[model samples]
Target: MRQGLGTQLRHLIDLLDGAVSAAYDEAGIDYRPRYTPVMRALEGGQPHTVSQIAEAAGITQPAATQTVALMIKEGLLESSPGVRDARQKVVRLSARGRDLLPQLHLCWQATRAAADSLDGDLPYPLSEALAAAIAALQHQPFGARIRKARAAITKETS
Candidate 1:
C-alpha cells in the first residue's frame, strides 16, 4: 500500500531530524532544532519582544513564548520587561548562550552544507518544494481545502 502524504512527510522529518540531532550530539552541543529559529532571531545580541522574535522566526507567538521560557530555564536566554511596554517581555541571549554560539554556528554551517549536498542530489530541491507548499497554503489554507473536500463527500454520500 502507498503511504499517505502525512506519513511520508513525517518520515522525511524523522530522517532529517535524526541526522541533525546526531550532528549536534557529535559536536557536543546541547541544542534542539526547535531552538534554532529562536536563536537565529536573537543571534545578533539584540533584545527583542516575543512578538518580534516570533515574526522573525516565522513561528507563532505562543511557540516563541514557550521556547523562550524553556531557554530561560536552561540558562540560555535572558528575559526582561520591555522598556516601553512593561507588559511585553523582551529577551536576548544569556552569557551562557553567547558562549555556546561559536560551537553552534560551526554546527549550523556544517548542517547547511550537508543540506545543500542533499538538495543537489534530489530531482527537485526540497527547499523549493517547501517554499511552493508554503505559498500555496498561504493562498488557500489546508483547513479550507479539507472543508471543501468534506462538503463534496457529504453531498455525494447523501
Candidate 2:
C-alpha cells in the first residue's frame, strides 16, 4: 500500500522536527521545536493578544492559546489580562525567553541554512512547494475539494 498525502506530510514533519529538537537539546537549550512560531511572533518584545499571535504565527487561535499556556508554564512567556478586555490575555516573552534569544537566533540560522541545502538538493524547493500549497488551499479549501471528490465517488458507487 502507498502512503497518503497526510501520512507523507506527517513523516516529513517528524523528520524535520526531530532534527531541530535534537539540535536544541545538543545546544543545552530547554526549548521545544513547536515553540519556534510563537517565539518568532514575540521577538518584537511587545505584548500581544492570542489572536495577534495566531495571526502572526500563521496558526489557529486555539493552537496559539494552547502554546501560550505551555510557554507560560515553561517560563518562556508571561501573560496578563488585557486592559480593555479583561477576558483577553496579553502575552509577552519573559526574561528567560529574552536570555535565550542570542542562542536561539544562532540555532535558527543554522537550521535555516540546512533547510536551504536540502532545498537545493531537490528538483523543486520544498519551501516554494509548501507556499504554493498554502496559496491553493486558501483559494479553495481542502474540505471543499474533499466534499466534491466524495460526492463523485458516492455517485459512482451508487
User: What are the lDDT scores of the predictions, listed in order?
Assistant: 0.93, 0.97
How many clashing residue pairs appear in each of the predictions shown?
0, 0
Question: Among these predicted structures, which one has the highest TM-score?
Answer: 2
List runs of model 2 lying over 4 Å from the truth. none
Clashing pairs in 2: none
The residue-by-residue lDDT of candidate 2 on 14-81, one tens digit each, is 99999999999999999999899999999989999999999999999999999999999999999999
Per-residue lDDT tens digits for candidate 1, residues 48-143, read 999999999999999998999999999999998889889989899999999999999998999899989988999999889999999999999999
Task: For candidate 2, give the lDDT.
Answer: 0.97
